[model samples]
Target: MNTIPEIATRLASLCNEFKFVEAYIELYADNAVSIDPNNKNEPITGLHNLIEYEKRFLSNVEIHDIKVSEAIFAGSYFSLVFSMNFTVIGQGSKMVEEICVYKVENGKIVSQQFFIG
Candidate 1:
């Protein structure tokens, strides 16, 4: 993708299509850092850890539907909002929403942070 909005669109498409792992592999830099909702929680550092974290998250998810909306791009930053309708292990139908932002450089995401709801 040539523009930040394009990149954000691509990422949103990937996640909505249940290709979350592929999105991470293609969009993130080698040393990308990912933070969970709370600052108190240690951020997942490095590409490998990021991939593993995504895999773990997806493995437990049984996607009924997913919607990605509100992608915003400004300079070297982008934000995407998502709502996932799914089921997790030991849980029934549930809806989870997360607001994610990325610090992007040279077309690859350098750092990402998530706020869960």
Candidate 2:
């Protein structure tokens, strides 16, 4: 069994902290999807767009009090809850929690989806 910690830590470090493009790209497949509740038009695809979209969001962003929960590792699928305090431009800071499910293969995420409320 592969440790979910490896993937989780990388994701947290890349997305929540450094916004490392290379690490971010390494996590997803060529055709990955991200569904965002805050944004109406989502499920964005492709690695380049994913990195660019993340860069666009994290350009002047701040996150705190991040917690991951409900992590279930079932072979090729991993699901977890990511909760954090986020501050974005134009939109004030708020504490939000989203459920993210990742489909993994060969230690890399092939597809990812987010369900937020």
Candidate 3:
């Protein structure tokens, strides 16, 4: 079972490499929940649903760069600052910065919530 720090490290590495789905599949629990403020502020429950949501988003954007900060941990939770530069298909380029917080239980990430900045 991976510790919080270990999971955080792997998540950051995978995200930096643009392996978002891979990270999710490897680190998240089956019934994981994802809350994205930009997505109507509704929680997307289940790993399958979360992955589908991510895929939809990815299909609509051309990611230019991604920067993930070192994780800050407190008990079973950890947070990271993610800055992404991307272009929406047929739209325009934009940069977004967000604080991503994750909750880990029994070696798997059970929930993630993002705060856009």
Candidate 4:
């Protein structure tokens, strides 16, 4: 993607298709930081860390459905809302509404944060 808006649009599309690993590997900078709701001790920094984090999160979960809301873009930042249903291995299926915010710099995602309420 040539611009941040394009990247955001594609990122949301990848997420809707459940391409979590590909999304982070392709769109995130080498030193990007990702803050997930699962662990908040410190932000997961670097592309490798983000990829591993996503991999671990997706490893045993059964993805039931994903609905991606239209993204809201402001400057080089954007937010996407996801309604997801999944079964977390030992845990039963659950539905969650999460908002993911991304900050794009140099055409790569420099930082991302997730919020679920």
Predicted model with the maximum lDDT: 3
- Ranking of models by lDDT: 3, 4, 1, 2
Q: How does each model score on lDDT? A: 0.85, 0.71, 0.96, 0.88
- Per-residue alpha-carbon lDDT of candidate 1 for residues 15-114, written as tens digits (9 for 90 to 100): 8889988988888889999888644557889899889888887788788999999688777999888888888888788888888888888888899988
Structural similarity to truth (TM-score) of each candidate: 0.90, 0.75, 0.98, 0.95
Off by over 4 Å in 1: 38-40
Question: Candidate 3 on 1-117: residue-level lDDT in tens?
Answer: 499999999999999999999999999999999989978889999999999999999999999999999999999999999999999999999999999999999999999999999
Candidate 2 residue lDDT tens string, 42-108: 6787878888887887687776567766467777777878787878767788888788888876666
User: For model 2, what is the alpha-carbon lDDT of residue 85?
Assistant: 87
lDDT of 3 at 114: 98
Per-residue lDDT value at 83 in model 1: 88
Winning candidate number (TM-score): 3
Candidate 2 residue runs with Cα over 4 Å from true position: 1-5, 12-22
Residue pairs in collision within model 4: none
Candidate 2 RMSD to the real structure: 2.9
